[model samples]
Structures are given as structure tokens and as C-alpha cells.
Target: MTIDMNTLDKAILNRIQTRFPLTSRPFATIADELGSTEKEVLTRVSRLKDAGIIRRIGGNFVPGKVGFVSTLCAAQVPEEKLDLFARTVNTFPGVTHNYLRENAFNVWFTFISPSMTIIRDNLAAIAEKTGVRRILNLPATHVFKIKAKFDL
Candidate 1:
């Protein structure tokens, strides 16, 4: 699963992991910083994304400041219904991250919504729909380190 990346690819990955210009033409800005053309930057980024080097490109907002609350949810899904349960959970707009683990509570995800009520309702609906009885709702108790930077 080793992907051979060129200098530009490595530079793009490393640079973007820390700072991406907040501009209308971000790729153009990156191109300027990298001594390359906008087209070249865009094309290389597209190739990187297509090759699965980049999972996503978006903004991260502070939940409380932006009128949002987030929670971590876990469900003990049976092996037979894992696929259906995951697909159903993914339908919610607020469900940002979902994962399958090798544990008693095998399914986990993070969700964000305008209020705790909405978050609870969504979790209840998911539980009822999927016939999953035991769901652990873990809300953030404190703020800690939350950053992902790679020097690739």
C-alpha cells in the first residue's frame, strides 16, 4: 500500500497539513508559495485525491462558538447487521466520523448538532431504527489536544 509521491506531492501534503491559505483561490496561493502554476497545483491535488492520499479538504470550526454541540456514540452492532447499521447511521448530516472496531461496542461515531436535544433525538432514532439497544453517549468533558500534522 505504498504510494510513490513526488516532490510536489510531498510538499503539498506537508504544507497543507499545517497551513492552507484562507483565500478565494487557495490553490493559486499554494502554487505561488510552491513555485508552480495554479493549474499544476490543481492537477496535482486532483491526482493526490484520486490516489487516496487526501481523504478530505474542509474547514474545522469550534463547536460551541458556532452554536453546535458534539458527542461520541458507540453501539454494539451484531455482525449480521453491521453494514445496514453503518449505512443508516451515515445518513445523518451531523454524523462526522464513524468507525468499526473489534470490541463489544463495535461501532463508534462522532456527531454534531445545534443542541443536545437534536443530538439525543438523532441517537434515539438511530437506535430504534437499527434495533441496537445499548448505545453509549460520551460527551466531551474537557478540551485537549486536537490537531493532525504530518511532515510527509
Candidate 2:
């Protein structure tokens, strides 16, 4: 699905991908930078979001630094139950994201919570709900943070 984007739309995307303003009127700031009005910027942003060009707009934090724990979880979900399994997993607020992989452990996701016990309990709940018992939880001993900005 290809979406048509004008120059201002592309500029809005590029600006917000990184260095988003830390102010009360962030869109206004973006508008000023792009030589557009806040209303125009907001309209464009809303259109882009509605078109699914932007999945989400939020901050990414280091779980450990913020008194939270994170782990990488993988599950072997049968093809027939992929939708069910993915939906059940996504219902948990701690699940950041999940994707299908071309491997034995086909469904993989990252989960974050205040403690490992909570994560384990959630994993157990997921297994019971989805009936996919072969779930692996791999906690990271060390974390490597990287910048993930796209040059739109």
C-alpha cells in the first residue's frame, strides 16, 4: 500500500522521527521549523497517522534505568493459531512488540515489567491462554542501546 506524501508531510515525518520538541506545543515547534502553521502540521500528522505511516509516537526508555525489567520471549506457535497467539500476547500491557519469524520459535516479542516474577507470571498466563507451551524467556545481562532514526 503506497501512500502519497507531500513535501510538508515528509518534513514533518523527518523532524518528528528524532529531535521532537520537548515543549507544550511540540507541533507548533515543528511547524515553525518547517515554516508551516500548527494547524497545518497537526492536520498533516493526523493524516499520516491515519494512513498508518506512523505506528506510534512516544518515548523509548531503558527499562532497567527506570526500575523495570525486560526480557526477550520466543514461542513456537502453530500457523493455524498464529492470530490467536499474537492477539493473546498483545493483550498484555507489558508486551512492547511481537513479530513472526521464519524459524521454529516463530513468534518472538519483548516484554517489560517491574520484576522478573511478573514477567514470568504473564508468560505463564500467555501459555495457558494460547496453549503454546514452548515459550522461552531470555533476560539480558547487559543492554546495548542504539539510535533508530529513519531519514525520510
**lDDT tens readout by residue for model 2, 17-131:** 8877999999999999999999999998888888888877888889999999999999999999999999999999888889999999999999999999999999999999989
Q: Where does the lowest 10-residue lDDT sum fall in candidate 2?
A: 1-10
TM-score for each of the candidates: 0.84, 0.90
- Which residue pairs overlap in candidate 2's backbone? none
Candidate 1 vs. truth: CA RMSD? Answer: 2.2
RMSD of each: 2.2, 1.6
lDDT of each: 0.86, 0.92
State residue 64's C-alpha deviation in candidate 1, in Å.
1.3
For model 2 the TM-score comes to 0.90
Which residue runs of candidate 1 sit more than 4 Å off their true CA positions?
Answer: 1-3
**lDDT, model 1, position 50:** 86
> Top TM-score: which candidate number?
2
